[model samples]
Target: MTEATNDTTSPVRPLRDALTFLLIVSATFGLQLLTLVTGIIMARLLGVEGRGVIALVLAVSVFAAQLSFGGCLPPAITKLLAERGANARDGLGHVFRRRGWLLLLPCLVAGGLMLVLLDDGAAGQRFEIAVIAVVVTLQTLFFSIIGGAMQGEGRLVRMAWVALTPQGLFTIALAVVAALDWGWSATDVLLAYIATGVLSVLVAMASLLPAERGDDVGAERRVPEASLWSEARGNYVSGVRPLDGLGLERILVGGLLGTTALGLFATGLAVSNLCRLVSNAVSVVVLPRVAAHQGDPAQQRAVVRRWFTISLVLVGGIVAVLELLVEPVIRLAFGEEFVGAVSVARWLIVADGLLALRRVLIAALQGQGRGGVASWVELALLPVLVVGIALSALRESLDGVGMSLAAVGLLSCLALGRAVFRAPSARHRGRATSCTQQRRW
Candidate 1:
């Protein structure tokens, strides 16, 4: 969202909520640091071309999962879970029973395609990549559900453990793989990722287990989340969830400008995504909290404003640092072959900051289970993204892609800004959401 009004008389935020945000931010730091290290190692090992190849593969994997599967289930479940109370168990069970099998196809498709792409490399490589991709994708889904459970339940510290454990495992896996002298090809790296995913899933499951309730009481988040938003939760099959991959920019980039450009662009992506760690940490912790207090539009706007303020404050410093150090960072992290990413990286960090801000507002809307007027405005710009990114890709200009991103980011801020500040009463969204839920049933 845009800059919030400086309302000195805004109510004081709860110390507990502030603390939760800090803990998640701390965990996000650890997670992203681990990821940064992993990316650097992988980039060094894979070289520019191979790194780009993996990026294209990533784009494909994301496309297959988000587009085909309709990416809104987990967060919807999260909001619903908080509001479900006595129905939590039944609601969750119904979700998995009905949709669990649907999850397998997308993961399989992603892994199968990656396997096919690697057919000419090595038989073992193909097998390993396919297996790891499928496993990782599966783990991703499980991780989302478990993490969302924590989010809705407002177990921020526990959620932090779940989020951070995988990264720790990843670092360990990389060390083991390197010690074992498995050359860091895409297959080898992905294999390590799979191992981390398995371990992380175990950690998440453990954290969520009933036995841990005693220990978590110290964090003031021990209660069950079923009662958080009992009255205002959305239908299970709500509107299209804010799945980042649903955007077709990267796939189109790979298709039009070729994989080499994809590689260069992915380099920038690696750097730019670092900015999301902050904003997502905010969104992840804030969504359930806001959703828990859904009815008061004034309180909601105040919460959005707080988040918007945090976004500007954090992003300004992050972008400045990244801009100043872009070249040296790229050179040291991914080497000279990816020097082209420096310019793109600078632009992307800005785009990503705005995107992250937009994400917070989207999470705010989702917390209420129904989007406001601005959500549709953002959706209507989906065509703008397609056309902009496509035209940019066609011109073989990474700069164009960055510019397109900035334009989209600006529009998203305006749209989501309007949403948070000018949201309609719950009545206005009732009919549309009911119709969709009815159709889904």
Candidate 2:
């Protein structure tokens, strides 16, 4: 399992790390490109109204996913496995039995809510959509458990494959659907996601389970006993898990606007989010390394500084290019009605850039066991987003939604800055001061 970890003090290691990072980026780009292409195809197939219903339904699906995986399982498991290195299966089994099992009830509940929304709120094709939502949520829950195991073992290439399989499968399914002239309703399109979920879980399980039978450098070593899911409690929802809150916001949009409006907004979101997809690829590779190096504060800072610079330069350059092409691209992809999407989209690209940087920052913080800072950051941002997006969508201007999201990104930047840039000793002194005041009182 040994590879180019971040713990090395070798001078030439940076070059190797850079090369490896590029590979990760390249692989990640392929996955995201597949997703973008799938979106474009789906948009063309379904037109605006179909696309909106698909977007809203998928939003609900994403929320079920979040609730099912729980917040802390992936990172917590990954961190624990990275540290122990002795018994991957024991750590993994404990995690699944504890927090992973807990996700089933929430998945069922989210699925039930999705059924209510589809049957009563969405109407038409309700049975099919509801069934897919429940089944897919259950599929994702198991897939996530295996995914956490892959990450925990630092089998990153394997992990990337698990991540990419669903997109690849869905892309292929779309092609077949198009070839067959399947009527591209929202329900018709969602079958691609559901089918892919089942297939990918099988692929991920094949990767995650093999490490149990194999021996590695850390396999025979002994360590102190601990619960697999010990870290699954507090920050699980906020910092530990992917933001379901974002999905809920989209649902809010669907409720406020009709399907067509939601589709337009979703298109703008998807376009702007392309850069975020790339940045997230960088993070997927970076997190385990960060977690491995968390014991040394000096190494942590160095690691943070290096990646922060890389993110700014890389994401900044991509943002610049995307900004220039935003208009022509939107017009070409979805036609004249969405030309206004370009204006809204440019701001969202900026927001995505900021959010991407925050990902790097949060990965570092979570690696260092300061996950509470990230949890607090999310807690603070949610209200700002909910209110801002609510007012803007109600006002019938996507420009408002774009600007509000940008504002949230900016706020996240500042919060991460406080956590990242503040000296540890200074933070300690501040905490000490607060503690003194509390004791005196």
Measured over all alpha carbons after superposition, the RMSD of each candidate to the real structure, in angstroms, is: 7.0, 5.6
Can you give the TM-score per candidate against the true fold? 0.79, 0.85
What TM-score would candidate 2 get against the native?
Answer: 0.85
Q: Which candidate number has the best lDDT?
A: 2
Superposed Cα deviation of residue 11, candidate 1 (Å)? 11
Question: lDDT per residue, candidate 2, 1-441, as tens digits?
Answer: 323344456777666566666766777778878877787788878887778777777777667666545345565565556656634565555434454556667556655766555423467666666677766667766766566667667676667656788889999999888878877677767877887878888887766644344454342232223544455555475533343233765777776766677778777877777666666666664554555554355676777787778888988988899899888888887677666567778888888888888887877776555667788888778788888888997798777887887888888878986797555665654554454344221
Q: Which candidate is the best by TM-score?
A: 2
In candidate 2, which residue pairs clash?
71-236
Query: Residue 22 in model 1: shift from native, Å?
Result: 0.6
Residue-level error in angstroms, candidate 1, position 363: 3.0
* Regions of candidate 1 where Cα sits further than 4 Å from its true position: 1-13, 68-70, 84-99, 112-132, 176-182, 211-247, 285-296, 367-374, 423-441
Cα deviation of 316, candidate 1, in Å? 1.8
Off by over 4 Å in 2: 1-7, 10-12, 68-70, 86-90, 94-101, 115-121, 209-226, 237-246, 284-299, 426-441
CA lDDT scores, all candidates in order:
0.64, 0.68
How far residue 127's Cα lies from its native spot in candidate 2, in Å, is: 3.8
